[model samples]
Target: MRISRLYTLLLPAIVACGGEGDSTSTTTSDQTLDVDSIAAAVADQNLPSDSLNEYLRENPFDVDALIERADRFIRSKNIPYAEADVKAALELDSLNPRVLLYWGDVNFYKNQTRQSRDAWMKCIEVDPNNVDCRLKLAELYSIVQNYRESLRLVNKVLEIDPSEPVAYFIKGNNIRDLKGDTAQAVRYVQQAIELDPEYWAALDYAAVMLANMHDPTAEVYYKRMLEIDPNHQPTYYKMGMFYLDQEMWNESIAAFTKATQLRPSDAESFYNLGYINLELGVNDVAIDYFNKSIQARQVNHRAYYGRGFVYERMGDLIRARSDYQQALAYNPQHEPSRIALQRLAEKMAQ
Candidate 1:
């Protein structure tokens, strides 16, 4: 259950957009042109007015042009400008399916779920053949934990693009997370890979699913994902956990140590390292790692539990109880810490 919660916190970091080269020290001329065009489009639209028709009268091929503007504004996190751009595009071409789809995307980013759904509905109305919009709506629902709605949309996308790997990948993700049907999830992911061998997101999702399945084939998947994207943070963390689960202590320690080196303040890596060290009876090292883990995430119950275990082994009953109490304070159902607390209470009575 602790691992499950940890998975929730770590998912975004694993699937975050772009790589290290996403941001640049210098903007190129093309980037500057894109930004300027977008800013001008936003200025022309001037939301709160019905200026889209007038603007399009002057620039008839404006739908694609305005979309570029919206992209720039969205990337820059200029929400107001982005929203205006999307609205302007919609106003110019209300029947333009892609514009409506992007309107939904903008709303989704702004946390306007109902508005997003409305926009997606409009997109489907305009272009009943647009699978991408449906797929995106499904992903948005998944983000909010609306699995049933998500599944419906994804299934619709599959109906349109039968060979779409992403549709199957998302289907597998929802099944793996919500239903815990690992075997079915694994098969879906594998089918996705067979459809699109170079799909990195599908590969990454499959690697995680394989690891969770405790399958020996998980290493093959992880290594393949690493080959495609070496600096992927979640992949490293998952690899570490996989080794740890196998009780391959040295391999586990090395994987976790590398993970920490790559992401210095990651609490899970530190906590795992501390727990493993405590198990191996390296009390001083365990304490040091636990301290680092707590520093990274003060509320981490596993770090406190690992520290308590070390303290109990060292015959420090009072300190052990204190750490156990802290662990239970964070996670009441943490069985090891609860047992440690019970033993400490028995010792006190004796």
Candidate 2:
């Protein structure tokens, strides 16, 4: 079975939770800290870019310096330079756990999943107590639909640190996927949030699950998440979906409008807003939003179908037929468009 897009988004957070261990620290487990929080902390301590460049010039062969510079590159989303630094570090010490961890991060960002897994596995082999690597591997396994292996690794993480919020979050996802046990999944995710109320991933997952269960508390979780990170585009999209499910058209429109504002190029948000407007019998508004959706993604069959519907409603049969045909050209199996085309033909015969 294909994993849902919602679950797929969680993979990055799972893999990113583990950071490279500090070589000077006595315990290796400290290196497995949350990547975002660790990056924020390190950003304050990081040498300025010019200073790092000058230091690298003086000590070109220093492995720690190379990794530190690579970390800076990673934070800046410069994957190529980060990979080069990781490669340089690996050449100096092939078995360095920190370098291997960074290697995995770079590969993961580049969408080299197998390579990332290999790097993280090597890191674990070098230091079995690396909870971060284990968690990341579990996430990769889950992505590949190896739920049993994913659960085994996640359970190991819990054994190592029961309070680990990400571990609980993954456990919830695994249970939901493996057994369709949403109730149990919600409990596990709720535990994760209880452990760390500020965990945005867990909060979003919990809200989605609660919304699926038709629980009013889902809105509360969404509101809390927005309070924590107002600019999170995905949260707004999810909120729009939740309100759509509840048939709250105005609320859904508001949520999706915010999502579009946050991510102007995201065609899905505009498509959703168009759909809501269509449902509310606002044909002109729906057509305008659908046009915007198509502008954002020209190959969008749903947008074509939506515009076709609006044109048909306005008695413009020629344009309606053209759009329905365009929708079918994009997706021949689009049943609504197919049906619309057939009905248009029947009306023309009359």
Per-residue lDDT of model 2, residues 123-204, tens digit only: 8999998787788778778876688888999899899989887788888989999999999998999998999888778898
Worst 10 residues of 2 by lDDT: 1-10
Q: Please, what is the TM-score per model?
A: 0.72, 0.72
Q: Number of the top candidate by lDDT?
A: 2
Instruction: Give Cα-based local distance difference scores for all models.
Output: 0.73, 0.80
Residue clash pairs of candidate 2 = none
Compute the lDDT of residue 317 as modeled in candidate 1: 83
lDDT per residue (tens digit) for residues 1-350 in model 1: 01000012123421221112222222221333333454465566563323543454467567876766566555555655566666777878887877877776565555555666777778887777777667766676676677788788878888888987777877887787789898888788888889877666677777776777687788887888778878877778889899888888998898888888989899999999998898788999999999999999999898888888898889998888999999999999989888888888998899
CA displacement after TM-score superposition, residue 320 of candidate 2 (Å) = 3.6
